[model samples]
Target: MILVSGCTGSLGDTRTNDSTDDPTTGNPTTGNPTTVDPRACEDGTVRPGRAPLRRLTRFEYNNTVRDLFGDTTDPAFSLPSEDVGNGFGNDADTLSVSSLLAEQLSTVAEGVAQRATATPDALARLAPCASNVSPEGEEACARTIVERIAPLAYRRPLAAGEADELLALYSVGRTDASFDVGIATVIEALLQSPDFLYRVEWGTSDPEHPELRRPTGDEMATRLSYLFWGTTPDEELRMAAQAGELSTKEGVRAQAERMLEDPRARKTIRFFFDNLLPISNLADLERNAEAFPTFSRQIGALMREETQRFLEHEIFEGTGTWASVLTAPYSFMNGPLAAFYGVSGVTGDEFQQVQLDTTQRLGLLTQAGLMAGTTHSNNTNPVVRGSFVLQKLMCQKIPLPMGDILERVKPPDPYSGATARERYSQHSQDEVCRTCHQYLDPVGFTFENYDAVGLFRTTENDVTIDASGSLPGTPGTVSNATELVQKLAESEEVHDCFATRWAEYGYGLTLRGEDTCTKQAITTAFKASGYNVKQLLIELTQTDAFHYISVASQE
Candidate 1:
């Protein structure tokens, strides 16, 4: 149960061990560190704070097994869903293994190992030596396989003792079954090993600064593969690590650039957007059936696909900038989704690029999946929509209303007025409620032209929709969703927040004061690049936060 430094950080500036909240005060209390290293970040160098041990998410695990043993069965789905801490499922702090998860892991590992060693072709792909050798050579062949596969599985070279442990497991299997079964036994052990399950990095020492430690080349290779490919590193990347190419920032950037061009990088990019945006489970999204007769689960699924395709196209195929993501006057849609949106002539399941009518829609903000996912089943909620844009895009924290305040300030009924603006006007009218809603309602009101299901509307209850609202930092009010996204595309706050989110996703750290300098440098570079998403990803690899680590103890 050895924990890393900063493993239980408080919601404060100081590093402390007491992460529990005080019952009376409702504020976290800090405690002195159980152990401290005298050599700490001193000269204002960018502090690469320690991250907790990371277990692979279901997505990562499935991708890894696919690349590792050519098993595309997606065995990891049997495990529990990950806790989405700090806006991402991959956040390390909340990835601890539960007793249920531990039981599920054993079942999953057994199933994957059985499939991997089932056929002769699979056995040969894993270890040719297993079949080529005679009866006496079976044990030797097993050793050869373990030596070769264990490093790839652990993502680092195994110590002599670790190798012996795997060989011992092989012996137990050999005693019970055939050689292939023995190999299966070894595979089961490898899959369930802590070395295979958790990314445990006890970094190598730094001669230049004894206080700071850095990830070994192999560890860096693991980071690069998971961040870019969302899977295990290929042979070329492993060789680069073995050759000491990942020790320098330039070398890391070169590898990252090459990895980004691979097809697997497309999946990684889509995965990030899936977590960051509101389109994760659109197929199961609820909607008022009678209000929209044509809306089906299939259509909801198409809505999610449209958003994913739009993101992949903009970041990779289009201009590859934040501005393009927010203000592009085009989207990808299939015949079904097109028909759902009332656009004609699109005729199949495959998605194609379609020019949007710029007057009513622009970029991701106007995407149906996002709009529908954030609103209610029967009516649009301005408070929910506005809070998402503010907290996610603007990085503004909205404190919860105290006690019975939320009960007293319930959302206005949709039938209370002819238009959504009139119905939600109490948010601005009430002095107590206006204090918090003022920051949210303005930005949310601009999307009033879109109904609960995100279809464009000119009127509600025979009243013309008035979608005019102002943002806190923008120069003036916007006329509609299109104009609002345009203003957001030009916002420095939006750019900075986008950069911060990427850093958090890439490094798997909840950024703090220790990461301030590092975060600032990344945002500065992102702005300089005109908010190019690809360039920001490369810039993430070149920072101290990606290359170094702070160990909690000598272990």
Candidate 2:
């Protein structure tokens, strides 16, 4: 996780001006010490840093199989659950292969092979010469099919020996059964290959920098497609790789621009936010229906869709800036969601765009889905809600509450005359609780106007709600959700935190001290571009961190 310490400062400052700096590390003068250029530490030196071999996440596997064989069965759904790292399941470090998973892969591969060759026409499409009467013609057709499909499945051109080995498998199946069986056998083998299961990336030494290395064109294509599309490269992208179009920054940008315009890019954008805000958990969210009569499993599904639609409109249809997303005063809602928000004029199942009352709602923080998802089933929990803002939005590391404190911080009593705020005020009275809640409770208190299920409420037990709080190091205090969101929108710390999250998501690694310079360059460009998300993505693709690798020795 990236930890932000202190107030926002100049990200681009690469000079040391401390007088106590050692002679070997600072300026080499005796009389008066001057600022030393930090870039002199071999800045921009490309090296082949560590790139872990990653297995395809469940989503990636399902999507790639869908694209490859047009199978919509979602085979990976039956596989073992993946361990999440760096806030995403796709992180290479956590995707381990277990014995059960290996067995399931073989079963899935066979099932997919049967589905792909279910009909004569489907088999014909896959292997054109399968209908040929002569054995010689059938063998020739099998070779052609292997040669054509293996590269796409492997994501690189297959070696001659590899192709021969696959051909040998087909020949064995043909002698035992028939031509179609031979084709299905080949498909099963290819699907089970490591080349199909894992994304393999390694770097070759760069001539200009002997110690550094760069990804080959094919490897670059795979990286770009997975980063932007969350699946394998299409035929067009594969052609570009084979033609060496991914070898330069300009070439990569052209492909990225084209891919962004495609509909598939929407999937990647949604995937990022789904994990970031984590709407996926809402699908299975359980609530006390007896207490909150209107809430149900169906309402939870609608809530997820509402957030996705709102995000899509803001990101793609509107200006696509961080400011627009944070302060947008509108949301897309269907009958179920509209009823929950107490908004009128929207009926039926389809989500319609509704203008929000700025006094009541502002951006994602006020959205019913997020607000409801963050709270408990029966009542609101200030610590959970406040900790989310501090850690995820602001990138501050708040230590988890210990066992003793967790035992003491009891839930607020709803039937009591005390309001939610009054009931939870014990934190300020205890030393152990006050240490963290001093920073958390205030931020969470701003959302008290929304109940456990995110319905607007003015009072609890007939007592007025106090949605007032102060953000540490920020000027003034906010009294409501809208003011808090507006303050966050104007904060440089929030902007840098957002940028840091994107870097972690895009690069698939935790940001370390060595990455500060690269992150600074990206954040500087992000600010210069008015925080346009699309432009920020384009800028990230061109950074040295994306295009070149650092030497392992340096790492």
Candidate 3:
């Protein structure tokens, strides 16, 4: 009766063939695509690659428990921290369990189970058994409780032996203690099960395409809920799965649309941007008090909230376009941030939408949070700022500097009669450093107007700042941060890169070579939707990548 937790191999253990042959051109009767007709595969019939088993991240765990049991204790805070993969904490491949984590899970499960059954109302909602019933009736009530709650906890129907095992646990508890004790024991066991801790998605074989497998309705429902709502499926979503509504593209779209309109959608959207822009890390940003006399943790927190509020207002309340996100002339600011941005009339602690002076601020790229996070404690680091733009915004994979190259290529001192721009120019001089800095430094130099703390400045060390720079392959030169954001707003590469990033985040897997067709389709649809962020999310749920899974031959 040992329930084996589904511990698969390492992240890179799975091997996928990088065949260029399209699956659509193959014979329908046979699972082989033809090599002759290149156009036959262009109809977008590629099978989706398989996603590894995903463990819920700390944030996902907390949100899930809060939604699942109306518990707000945030027990996952005691769990080990999660590693970031593909720029997101939810990557399926990187999330793994260790012996320490297993012990932590067991301990947390006991506390959560006890809390869930703390009162008669709570016990009734969860187990619905009579307190003063006879022993036989108590056993019957325990069985009923196990049968009712296990599916929601596991996110799927129990297997043949699962219910009996839980009932057995309940029997031990009833004999040893009380009926409530029996139910709590079952609850504790279910919480620690692999089915609860991991998103165990295994697709059923597609009869029409034998080589391809489609996720079960329950699996798709779980995918949609976690992706859009950041929690387990609600009653309507669970009903949709049971009724087979999640099996069709139209069904998935309807649910996605409905969920997107709900208030939870705003939380999900904010979570995505929080990972994308990574403003959440600002809470831990350190600064020198002498260098930044006014900086404080309170200001750091306010900066994060400002960015989140601005994103939500634009995507949900306004037009929701990428252009508006990058070139919008307004932002949300509070008293502290307003002072930092050099804006007036915003006097309260609450964040209010204020129009920006086009000369200084433009879009998210110029936000104080991003500028401050990508800088050093005392002075601005153009290399860090530039790398953030190229790697995060454009999806370029920049290699890290090896050995002493970083130590050697240092910024010039302000007292040495050099501007920040002039200091970073030293990287371009050394042939070893120029290989990478040639691509990074130029783009970072465009943000010179914003200091390390993200305050707008005209000069450093009495030298007029030079914020002019150019992005390679872009049409025009950017004289300042405003122009840089505008130029990025109009670039097709930037749009597609953003699309690629969202795909990775939404799918919970890195975009591989085999995912080229699906990635391109998402990018195409994203472009057609006028780069609307909300529309792009709905469109992602409708793609084959979201519905179908590739089946291994042995399976």
Candidate 4:
């Protein structure tokens, strides 16, 4: 029931070690690659493509509150747990609306709506009504609310009838209560409405081109907001839709650029990174007290603060690139985290950046936050850590192990000299276990020198922790952390993985077989534009997929 969506680790485990040659489809015996028909598009046939119902992600909900009413209350903190697809919470297919979540949403909607209506800031957001009366006052008030909140909520202006319905809701509330309470009640309804919660988009059968139907400009606004901003559309985006520019390629690009400059865009990126990494200790990391008794609650706060500072310095303050993320020698630390990282100059109660010698540490490969999340209550999981790199960075999938394979689980002797790796290596010999364990353990062995939380250590048991291992699909057999970082940082697969993750997030679904084209375009555009995050945002908003909806199949 408590589905955790945004943990930055791999869920891959090996089962039934099997690698068959890529299946040949064209001429089974000719050895020629299968070729797809080129003219199929012109033929009258249904084509495969991506479709999604846009909605607010948990992170997007939190950020939107801050922007709309300066409220950072985290509704998603306890909103019904979300399922992760393709290693993210933004996957629309994995998202579900249940009675539990519905009830929670109702409560949140009530709280947020009341807060927005009462705050002077919220009233300031509303446009001045020409006059406060029955239909006329209602029309102006509804339009103003539509113009302001709808952009961030529904991502488009409500149709005149939809506006009238909203006005009617206002009327009921006004008749029963004060005008302010009535209007707030109407806002509550919009917040709770399915239209607001689930971003519904679909295909319209084109009369002239029956083979091609697409999402309208209004639908595209939701598509763009959820994908890039991870939240509702703002006034600017809704206005763009009204002007009909958002429907065109040029308009999409312009709006994306404008949105990047808006402060809220940063929140979108931060929330995603949080979900992708799931470093819980950024708020409060649970640590083993008996082993590292020196570790205090305050150190947990400092640890995450230092990392955030490092990201700010490198990404926004300096250059945001795959390389800089791993190799930047500086990190933040106060008295406690500084002591943990083994630095001496940092004073008590103050966080400042410090450069480390490479011998002491590497990139995220040896970071405490990442290490802590992957470790157990007692030990580090190399298999889990190895899987994280493969799935999160490389974008390769690891299959889940069958239930039968796990029941045979055996733990090494508690007092034995065997290290976690030596114990893990035993699985490689088991005919059933070896196939998958082989992939995870070797990668884990490379981090042997670091304990569960990434603190450097000389040995595990009696064996020296050897931090060297080869990657599965890399050229030449290389060893050591430096080579691993180099291979991962510059990989096309890594960049492609990032592209896939972002596009899936932007479109609010898993980037799968149908999304090949959108993914490629986003990757290409991002590269051509110097890997600017903002430019990629623009590309997603303008793409054909952003404006298309699917027709329901008959049962």
- Tens digits of lDDT, candidate 3, 1-555: 001112111111111212332233211212233222333437757656546777887777878877766779999989987766766777776778889999999998888888877777777776557444567687787777788889988889888998899999988876858777778898889888889898887878788888787889899999999889878888999899999999999999999999999999888888888877748778788898887887777788888998899999999898899889998899899887888677888898888999988899898889888888777557777777777776677665554543566465566564544677877775357776665666667788899898877888889878899899888567667799888898889887788878877888788777664566567778899999999999999988988788888664114
Question: Each prediction's TM-score against the native?
Answer: 0.90, 0.88, 0.89, 0.82
- Between candidates 3 and 4, name the one with more favorable TM-score: 3
Identify the leading candidate in terms of lDDT.
Answer: 1
RMSD (CA, Å), candidate 1 to true, equals 6.3
Say which candidate scores most in TM-score.
1
Model 1 regions lying over 4 Å from their true place: 1-44, 131-134, 427-429, 552-555
lDDT for model 1: 0.79
Q: Candidate 2 on 422-518: residue-level lDDT in tens?
A: 7667534566656666777788889989887788888876788999997765878999988998988887778776787777667765554455455
* Candidate 4 C-alpha lDDT tens digits along 437-499: 555566666666667666777777767766677676666644555567767776666766666
Error of 1 at 363 (Å): 1.1
TM-score of 4: 0.82
Query: What order do candidates take by lDDT, descending?
Result: 1, 3, 2, 4
RMSD value for candidate 3: 7.5
lDDT (CA) per prediction:
0.79, 0.74, 0.77, 0.61
List the RMSD of every prediction in angstroms: 6.3, 6.8, 7.5, 5.9
TM-score of 1: 0.90
